[model samples]
Target chain A: MAEFWMSEIIKECARQRISLAEYIIRGECENSGSTREQVIEKMGKMLDVMSSAANGGLEAPIRSNSGLTGGAAYQYHQYIGQGSSLLGTVMSSAVEMALSCSEVNAAMGRIVACPTAGSCGIVPAAVLSVGVSHQKSREDMVMALFVATGVGMVIGEHATLAGADGGCQAECGAAASMAAAAVVNLMGGSDEQALHGAAIALKNMLGLVCDPVCGLVEIPCIKRNAIGASTALVSADMALAGVQSYIPFDEVVTAMYAIGKQLPAELRETGRGGLAVTKTGLAMYETLFGTPMSL
Target chain B: MNATYMTGSYSVFDITGPIMVGPSSSHTAGAARLGKIARILAHNSVKKVTFQLFGSFAQTYKGHGTDKALLAGILGLNPWDLGLRDAFSLAEKQNVEYIFEPVTKPTQQGWENYHPNTVRFLITSENGEVFDIVGCSLGGGKVRIISLNGILVNFTGESPILVTRHYDGPGIIAAITSILYQDKVNIGNMRVDRKRHSTTADMYLELDSDVTERVVEEIQKIPGMLNVILLQRINEDQSLNNIE
Candidate 1:
């Protein structure tokens, strides 16, 4: 086992004259003891799952088992189809796709847990929407996924990705960061820009709580994923335009860890505080489970 | 000196996948993996199972589909199987009776201190053998088998393994390792557990690769060996007959 840093990865890529995705692929092959073809084959399968999940709820309205979230993605897609979106085609499709994937997850449809199931929608939405709008090939999308994976691994190593451990900042925030980096790479941004994009996205989401109402991944989780996708796009856009963060990517990750540790258990997916304990949230829980919400 | 972050133990896909039916990775997908591993450990003869949910597993299992996911796995369904959505009916069709018990307080002494996402499975086999196994879903589709039949042990089910029950006696570990050595099967890790003054002990060997049928037969033939079961790595493609 060796230490992995974004700076070292960038330096290695430059020295080898390879792209960030290629460097990650080579390292993954060595780590997993698999061949390049085998690693790519697995990544290809992941892209397929992401594609299906992103499209799962778009064809028709699907309701969550708890009846908490349903048809929002479909409604948004319909709205976009009517040319009513103010965010333009690319950003609108990102939100729509993010909602679709999150809704599908709530409905128990198969999905790739890009970091996690609760935040699964963000990365695929960010990657696939941009890929489709820009006419990137499937290979290009898979490479972008590798880029996301690289960023996620760093987060997982330095901090956490579980809402239970680090709140929504760790789940959706990390997904947005990963998605931002992937988008930068997809748009031909430099490795430094990709890392900067990740930093900006995560910095904006610091201290977000993970208060899933009734402990379900329906209400805030689904909507947050939609917003997460849009945030990733905005961050990537900023990075591509040469915007920079004063704090480096690793420092931001350290700050996120510090902030996460400061969060009380009530805000860490316990359904005991924040929006989960709101009057409406408690009422919904009582209606669904036929029991009063208790700590 | 710079701090290193690469553990080489986790693949990039580990952070990215385990393509599954999802609402929560810890509650749904990891629960399923735990159930499937328990089934394999029981030699797939499970006729009835009682899942005792603790902490987070008890509080949110229903909303997260943890109940259905556990049943689906015991019925031999992979996490990615669409049939997981119909696990209840599928269990009924297969005559697999099930129960879910939520525990807020310790039912017995020494029951405290379990992980927040722990479940203890009480399984009855078709042959009327009853055993209890405890597991924890450590978020992101990762699970650990913490105890089997009251013998405390630990393994992640990420690699091939052999669980054996044998008489507690000298030369037992040596005999098993020698057989594995002759077969050229590398041992990644191993643990042996036994109760004081008991005649029996359980040995768990996590292997880097699958062992051949001949190797299993040779180990089983050893004097004082009671049972030998081989479980494939749960992270890989699996079927009911993964055991020999």
Candidate 2:
């Protein structure tokens, strides 16, 4: 099994003259002891789940048990129908799809957590919305997942994916970066361009905290996923247009981990600070679970 | 700091914990999985069970649905099961009496180094057989069974596993390995844990794929082996159905 750093992955792609997807698939097969066909089948299953979640989230926007989030995705969809938005159909749909997944999660419905359940919506929202709008083939979408997984692997190898360990940046920021690279790959960008997309997406989200109100993955989490998808799309656009990030993807991930560590314990999913500590946030908690003893 | 997050090999599915009903993966999904595996290990109809939660699990169990998820798992439901929401009522219908208790840490006497998400199960079967198991939820719906009845053991539901308990002696591992080789079941990894070296021991082997019933019988016939349990991989386990 081959382990790759950012430099090694780039070099292997160049030397082997294989696409980044193939390099990643080969490494995955070797490490997991599964055949290429098996890995592809698993990726196919994942794509199916993502599509189901997006549709389910929108088709029935049930309120969460906490009542902190629900029906917002549907409202966003309704707004798109009004033609009152500046964002295009693709971008608007992506944001709505992202919100759909998070809302579904909050309602105790099924969702695929791309990295963590708190940041579940970013990759699927970006991939499915953009893929459907552009009419990308199933095989192309599966290839896109390999790209996303490859980038996720590098981040998982070098940085934390758990918010408790590295804050919201490690979860949502890492997921958006993964989605950016995947979107670039789906659009026929070079591997180098894909890495740049990831770097640009992550660079913009440095030091993002993970302060879910009342310790639930609703409230800001659902909206943040929407913004994360938009960030992914915009970063992909810049990378495809030949914009370069001064810091590479690996360094950006390293910085994300460092910044997450520097975050106060209150800001790292403890529900003691940030939005969780706000007057409105406390009031919502009081309404739902009753007044917290500390407050 | 070295600035690295490398841990172990991850499948593409690892990035996405298989489609699950959840408000939280560590608390809900992981708790369900622990319940499901404990049900299988019990090997008989569960009459009653008690869950002792430690640290983080004890802190926020009710709000996170950990309580419901755990009961749902004991009744043979997966994390993706919509019925998870009704697990409390379902447990009563199934005649599976259950209770939850909070503990600051593992009070199993000798065991230390507990994961904050750890839970200990004391399960009693209809046949009046009783057993104790300890497991830890490692976030993202992943779990590891760390012990059984105070004996050290190891298992993660990632692949097919063959767990055996036997008197600690010689050639026990080789006997199982030879049968697996003949059956063409590739061994992914193996771990042996004993209360005392050369005494009673538990053997855990992860297989690349499933083994046939005939192969299992052959291993069960080994001289020193007392009990053998075959556990399917989480995906292959029929307890979970894909939502879509």
Provide the overall lDDT of each model, using Cα atoms, as 2-decimal numbers: 0.87, 0.83
State the weakest 10-residue window (summed lDDT) of model 1 chain B: B235-244
Model 2 spans > 4 angstroms off? A1-3, A290-295, B1-8, B104-113, B159-243
Q: What local lDDT score does residue A90 receive in model 2, on the 0 to 100 scale?
A: 81
- Angstrom error of the Cα, residue B80, model 2: value is 2.5
Q: What are the models' TM-scores?
A: 0.94, 0.88
Model 2's CAPRI class? acceptable
User: Which numbered prediction scores highest in TM-score against the true structure?
Assistant: 1
For model 1, state the Cα shift of residue A63 in Å: 0.9
lDDT of residue A187 for candidate 2: 92
DockQ of structure 2: 0.39
Interface RMSD of each: 2.8, 4.3
Total backbone clashes of candidate 1, pairs 3 or more residues apart or in separate chains? 3
How would you encode candidate 2's per-residue C-alpha lDDT over B1-244 as one tens digit per residue? Answer: 3212222456666775566877788988899989998888788479999998887787778777889999999999888888888999999998899999977654646333568788888999999999798899998889998877655667787778788888888888899999999988998888887874466788888898888878889988999888887876655423333444
lDDT of 1 by residue, A1-295 (tens): 3367677677767767887788778878767778888888788888888889898888899999678779999999999988889997889999989999999999999899988999999999999999999999888889989889988888888898888789999999999999999999899998899999999999999999999899999879999999999999999999999999899998898899889999999999888889988899999999888999976
Candidate 2, residue B144: the lDDT equals 91
